[model samples]
Target: MQEKRDPLLNITTASSIEWGPCDPSVITNPALSCSFFEIPLDYHDPSIGYGRLALAKLNATQDRLGTVFLNPGGPGGSGLDTLNMLADILSSLSGGFYDIFSWDPRGVGSLTTPGEIFCFDSPDEYNVFWNGTVELTGIEMTGNFSDPNDVHALLAQAPIMQAKYDELARRCLRHSSGKFLRYVGTAATARDIVALADALDGPGSLVNYVGTSYGSLLGMWLINMFPERVGRVIIDGIVDPTLLATQETATAFHELADADKTYEGFLTGCALAGPQGCPIASAEGQTAADIDATIQALLKQAHDAARRNTSAPVTSEIIRDELLSVIESLGQAALFANTTWPMLVAGVQAEAGPESLTARRSTRSARRRTRRSSVSQQNQTRSYSNEAILCGDSIDLRRTRMSEVFGTVIAASRNTSEMFSVVWPAEFYACPFWPVRAVERYQGPFNKTLANKVMVVSNTFDPVTPLPEAEAVAALLGDNARLVRQDAFGHTSVSEPSQCLNAVMFAYFVNGTLPEDNSTVCEVDTDFEIFPGVNTEAILAAMVPRKIK
Candidate 1:
């Protein structure tokens, strides 16, 4: 009898990628090269066939040290796209010594397999489903959980959100291929990293890499899965592995603890910059507290309109979501979308009032009248890779009830900020509804004895990935990891355009140096004035505004 091979899978082979000119659609960087790997869908089992990943590399200009892999988070984020935009700058940041490589991780944005993760059939399907949801439309019903009336009003809608999410779970399952979806997660991607390292730098070569936000989680998985393979790894904007692996997506994770503090910093920065930069800033000694109060008043006015089922130019949910976005992008938000802080504020002035928005309210109400079950929906060639990857890694929450979600949301309000909590459902609320789980999810033993000390960089006031999470990871990894906190706001240290941060990173990668343990604090380019003015060099060196969040 002849030995039989698994028909669905490919045998693990020693493979190498051929770098060639990238397609104009995928990546238009003429200087960079593009290629891919035929990686096993299941690393441990060859029965799952092979999946392809799209990769891009920027070769070093000077004497090459080695290749350094980079991931820009999102769990589903496209490193290939990031490389295209920041190729020159990142190459320079690494001192033009190491080849910078990034890729479209499985199921993310690319024509590569497992393909783009989608819960729906098209943008129209999503827009229709989103019609009845609070995420798409700004919440006018209540401002926050301040008054009992508002709290009750918010809680009453919890079941609706839950019901909508439950249906969402069904649609995702109905639309997505469960077999391939299971492999489109971190553990497999981690294996792919090692495999890519093998192909690019010869088998078993130490992996040099940088990851931010969800990418940091992938880095942790990579380091732990192949401890000795870690060469020069930096995980910036760290995620709380504890919350990530075990908890359901929306259960008051530690990541949001500093969100409000980061927001306060934004308000203060606006006041400091004055009216020229921040529209809502007071000219007469306007304190951060005063600006916050003005925002609160605006929300209240929006709430009154919402109470009457009226539509304003901006709703409470929209403003609250924007608040969260601002905190996540405080550095880049200094000049976001060609609109400064003041202009954004002026737009949300509640100038039109409730009655003025009455005409718009009728149209909004008519569109929202379509109930969930009333229309039959179909799937589209779309992707929500973040949801797929994140929910798969997390412990399942199908058994959860509305009360638990309600309590969690309420407690989350206390934990982060009342305004932020209202907009929480947008990201992780549907995770419980995510039916697919990964084939392999790395849960614990994050403190593996690595080949080197993993450098963890973070912003002190990071809204999403907070500094304490970085501290905890550093403490957990013990001698295997070192933590460096840049005294700045936003999601990651690089967003602040700090020379100190960049120099420290370069030194660590090039010279194998970690900053003095607790004493490491890089200042923002704005405060110190020590870096002179924000020049082209500084902007290029710092992270591109599109952040890891």
Candidate 2:
């Protein structure tokens, strides 16, 4: 017989637990001391109630309730960090009605929960993981593997690493009394939001929730799971979960291509505006091709340099870092587009100092040098995270000859998405070779048949989740769902400019209001108001202005 379910326990919400002195660590560093809070790892476990999650809270004067959880949507990202960055923007936009609070999930950041299989012990180790492993033969680099077997073989002593992770996870789960490792999906996390609310108070407890990217998916899941429980949900950079599962390849490939387009736009925009005129433009025209070639050439140079510098039997692992940086740089549309302005400003500012030009040149030169090795390392780490979450949460792969099956798909699809087909290949090329499949598989309809309050926002030219995948997600939600089309070119529309779409989101979450139609199309940023700002430049200057005469 199954164990009897305990009757729900009634707990009183505490008013202002003194909040302890704001941790200077979070504030001084901006990176560290943000907000601090703790959650019992095993809310139900009585024997070892030791696990606590350190958190940070960011809010404007308009904040009413104690806090609101801010999720930035990285299964691996630090929520605390997300809130720190968005606090000002959110406050100004929302008129400061709620405090934004975020915590490192069970396995991440300062939470210290358990089940930490990540081998991020030292900078060198982290660098290695970030750069990933490659199968480079002779002087020229060749193929790379995302497969678990290949990775395991490469990290021959990885058993020790694996054991460390397994032990931590076991301890955390055991202490937390959480047996739902299989249920740690978005749905479960949504339910946890309810538990958090209950622990705080009912109904009007939290001010509102603001999420971006994966955060939006979590919001959707939460709203679906408990409609009446939600107060205000601001989901930016929205992702369609349903499409994410079923249309992984189709979505990913298209997004990658879209990324190339966005890069082209950035390059074009920079060229037209000129380096000194536009925040992003480099010293000269610094065309897009120049940037791309600069990055790629850096890799070759780094590899050659390393070869010459090291005759003491250098490993592919060492050279892979520069390569990983190159590959990852290709997908940095969001960063590249944003960085130009910042980098240009920084570069100009650096030019004023005696060592300014030298520093700037040195920095770029260093980046160019490491471009090759870094790419390999980044891919390795990313591949690990991808496998951990994707494979761990996905259904069991019963297909025999996984590699051949995926290889066939790649071959057939080469006509369309050639790069992806070549890079990702198929099941044969997958990481997490022996992933622990979810005990309960995700069925065709990614979500439960709840009323279609699901609001999906997809960019027309997203470089990650393609437009088609967004449509597929909306379709999966069926008649009850809605698809908000952001006529922008990027991943996750909410984060991009589109005040009209944002206003729609505010109305829906604030008052349970939905558009009359199931689909709403928003033009690009130039066509709409940028939220949280009537004048972004002035606001930015006021908030973090440069010292001037």
Candidate 3:
């Protein structure tokens, strides 16, 4: 029997593609196979050359029931890398009934689809122009705005930030690759997913997918854009599609409402772990007060250092932002059994040592503003790719005045948690000055009756993408979407290993089953404990290579 396919006229599609082995240097997975397929550079215009989408797939151990498309959100993150990282777990969870697959989306700089969106002539050029300036600074959680000094210090950088972005817009616009800006929007990528599915599963196969963070946004776009094609979709760490698509609201308006709750949870988790597991925990298993004091002192030291040097690397704000990151990445493979939390504690303790951070003036002087030599290829390209995708997909903010932009920042601080309001607004700091819009933007009536039910997952207390986002999205999706609340800390369900959550997900992927209802709740099997905590002499002795006797 022949399967049907609705090949997109705009994108170059196929019934089947020749698969090739992945480069051993880049990735060494026996189960993985890689391929590149062409899509339109400008779907609206054919004369514009084509861009290729790079895809990787983990073959099913059994006969493939279907293909599950996964995306690691980043507007710039490599989907292939995600497939590599989670292939084993996803393979096991689904019982290997299906092949797990993903691709490097356009503008991520990994694929041959114009490589990546680059505006600067060279890495050095980018560093030189951005040197000493907090241009395109991703929010470092420094400088709590409750204090007038911190608020003023934060607000003062608005001018310099704006000037840098305006210049960046100019430089990016003049660059040859800037022409690709319109081609990289989420809408276009949504189409690319369809094209890929058609090629892999004979054109019209149902699109089953799992997406987290920015990938969640892509999932929303997919279901709404091609509702009939949805087989089973799970979107976690959701972005409120309605809020993000609005021009007046600004990207920051989606808001990180649960950030404060997550912060509280971090302190609480430390308290729970006690003195043996956490550096800041109390000996007698007390409240979060000890943890708070330890952190507050570090912040004070950082703040004092920032006061002396405007360009200090470790500011109160940076510490706060890093803490937010530490919280978000709580249960990552490395953080789970490694030194993530302790290093954070030890790093701060070392920085905030006996002399109150004045001991570190040797490096963060006004003279050493240029971190040119320190810029890695990964950081530079990821930063550049992040801006290109985020800004390109967004409604143009170039027309918004600097004052209006600053107003959003101030409002985010007042309305949301002042502890991390600065962080959310800085997520798309480049958007307002972004010079291009993708060829297509999905301003949606996101609620559509789809071919299958959509599963929306959220951590009860996600640091960045709050539960309200998933709540609103699920509600908007109405009967078509099932909301599963994971009562866990950290950014998403991945922060904790939850047997309940995994079972629900596997059931959905294997058998198009939605949770019993919108109220379905899943509990994680573990909590956020410091990984490999402090090793006692007894524990160390146990680890020693011993004779059988």
Q: Which one is best on TM-score?
A: 1
Q: Model 3: per-residue lDDT, tens digit, 1-549?
A: 122322346655575777899866545777799888878777667677677877789888887888889887766667776777789998987779888998878876445475566667664676577665544223333434556665565567677767877887887878776777778888888988887787778657899898888889899999999999998789988988777677544445455687866666666556555666564654756666676776777777666665665555456655565576666755542342134334434444454433433322222211111110111245342135666766777765647756567667767767776667665325365677788777788889899899989899998778778888888898999999999988776777887678889999888877777777887877666433333342112221323242210
Candidate 1 lDDT tens digits, 142-197: 43465687667656777887788778777877774555678887888888887777
How much does each candidate deviate from the true structure in C-alpha RMSD? 6.8, 10.8, 7.9
Global CA lDDT computed for model 3: 0.68
Superposed Cα RMSD, model 2 = 10.8
TM-score of each: 0.85, 0.60, 0.85
**How many backbone clashes does every candidate have?**
7, 47, 9
Better of 1 and 3 by lDDT: 1
Pairwise TM-score winner, candidates 1 and 3: 1
* Residue 532's lDDT in candidate 1: 23
In model 2, the runs with Cα more than 4 Å from the true position are 1-18, 28-50, 59-68, 115-117, 123-132, 135-187, 203-208, 227-234, 243-257, 270-387, 397-431, 434-454, 478-481, 494-502, 505-514, 523-549
Model 3 scores worst on lDDT over the 10 consecutive residues at 366-375
